[model samples]
Target: MKPPFPTLIATAAVLTVAVTVAALAQAPDPPQRSAGSPPPAHAFPAPTNLKVLPKNLTGEQVHEIMEKWKIALGTHCNTCHAEDKKNPAPDGRPQLNYADDTKAEKSTARLMYKMVEDINGNYVSMVENSGVPVTCGTCHRGHITPEPFVAPAGNYQNNGPPPAKDGEAPKLPR
Candidate 1:
């Protein structure tokens, strides 16, 4: 006896799906990044210019640091890195000339980096048990230029003398 038309159609559909699944299973896997490898989109060549940052740092390390600073300052690479009009990227966008110091913002960034390093190493470290290190976000807080701090309006009341040190008793207001 011949199989019903619906049975034939079902068999054909099942065969088609099975063949497709087998073909997909035989296909090679997509390329994977090694543990130490950076993503293909962010693959940076070895850095040539070393100035304010540590000379020993790798391109990836520099990229990571710059990424942090970019986020902290609510800016982009173009803010500090000049565009290389001479060389365009594969997509025809102007490539960033990271080593170029022509931009004033780049110089200012270097100066700011040095200042932060000094603050962290010289000032913050001086206080015993001080664990917090100042970073770009400490002041910038996601702004390119930090907004000026405004003190809350209030009348100072002489509640009492300042709290005493370790051994001294609190003094009353005169």
Candidate 2:
């Protein structure tokens, strides 16, 4: 049976409103900017307290290296950087003190960087002829902390070395 004309019009109006509302909801918002505010296009500031990295590195080079560390550790700028309480930015966003080593994580990262450098220089050079050096990604794998190794479940006693081979005199150390 067909509904009355008024009823059909009301149903159509409701459907139209629903469709319009849905479309508006899904539409992307227009870019917003303040009349007096400019976009952040300034170059990154030069590094200050470069304890682990070379002191002679250019500010731009330091910035690029930091960017790589950010990617390798799957972290943001604030992960190791503390807010610049002394020289805050005008925009009210936390300005970072890139040189600050107060944060424990930052210190730990410094140690890790040194360890990686030593491994690549001293160890990898000795063992591998590939010429490709080890990097933070060798172990971190885009994680802040590499996964720990754990032995599989077993009934071995004392966690001692495996039994000596037969007739090997138990391989006792003098």
Candidate 3:
């Protein structure tokens, strides 16, 4: 005789669920970051009543701090976007292409310039009849402030589809 109707229906339902879960478990892992993604931007915590570099410093001391900001602050010249081969902006903001029709409506460029100037004055000291310089340890001393490192949240950058061939589009799962 045939199995009871209720028993057969329950078995089929259970099997279906088990198969679906198993299939899902076997799915591929998500993509990871590509080889050469740039690091996040450099930023500082807004210091309350912050001071500037020491006044009347020599050229060397003045320059030393600027260089230190790069490594200690977790920013390279290309922090914002593409960098020029020779000159690079310490803060990472890209320079606007004069020929381009589009320009950033906001005055971020001015803000960054002011920020760089303000930072330069903070701990700078003057030397006797000479220039001033800053060391990497000047601000970093080991810790990165305002520009602390935060781990990436997800793999957004590397998840795009492979290059299209013969103008055909890729299909997604149903």
Clashes of each: 0, 0, 23
Residue lDDT tens for model 1, 1-174: 885998999999999889767655664322323333334655667778878899987777788899999999999999999999999999997899998889999999999999999999999999999999999999999999998986454522334455689988876666
* Greater-lDDT candidate between 1 and 3: 1
Error of 1 at 28 (Å): 21
Candidate 2 C-alpha lDDT tens digits along 1-174 = 765998999999999889767655664322222223444355545667888899887676787788888898888888988888988788876788887777888998899899988988888888756587878777787899987766666744545555789887564332
Which lDDT value does model 1 have at 124? 100
Ranking by TM-score: 1, 2, 3
Candidates in order, TM-scores: namely 0.66, 0.59, 0.20
In model 1, the clashing pairs are: none
- Kindly give the stretch of ten consecutive residues in candidate 3 with the minimal lDDT sum: 97-106
Candidate 2 worst ten-residue window by lDDT: 28-37
Q: Report the lDDT tens digits of candidate 3 across residue range 34-85.
A: 3233432432222232124455543444445545555665655333224343
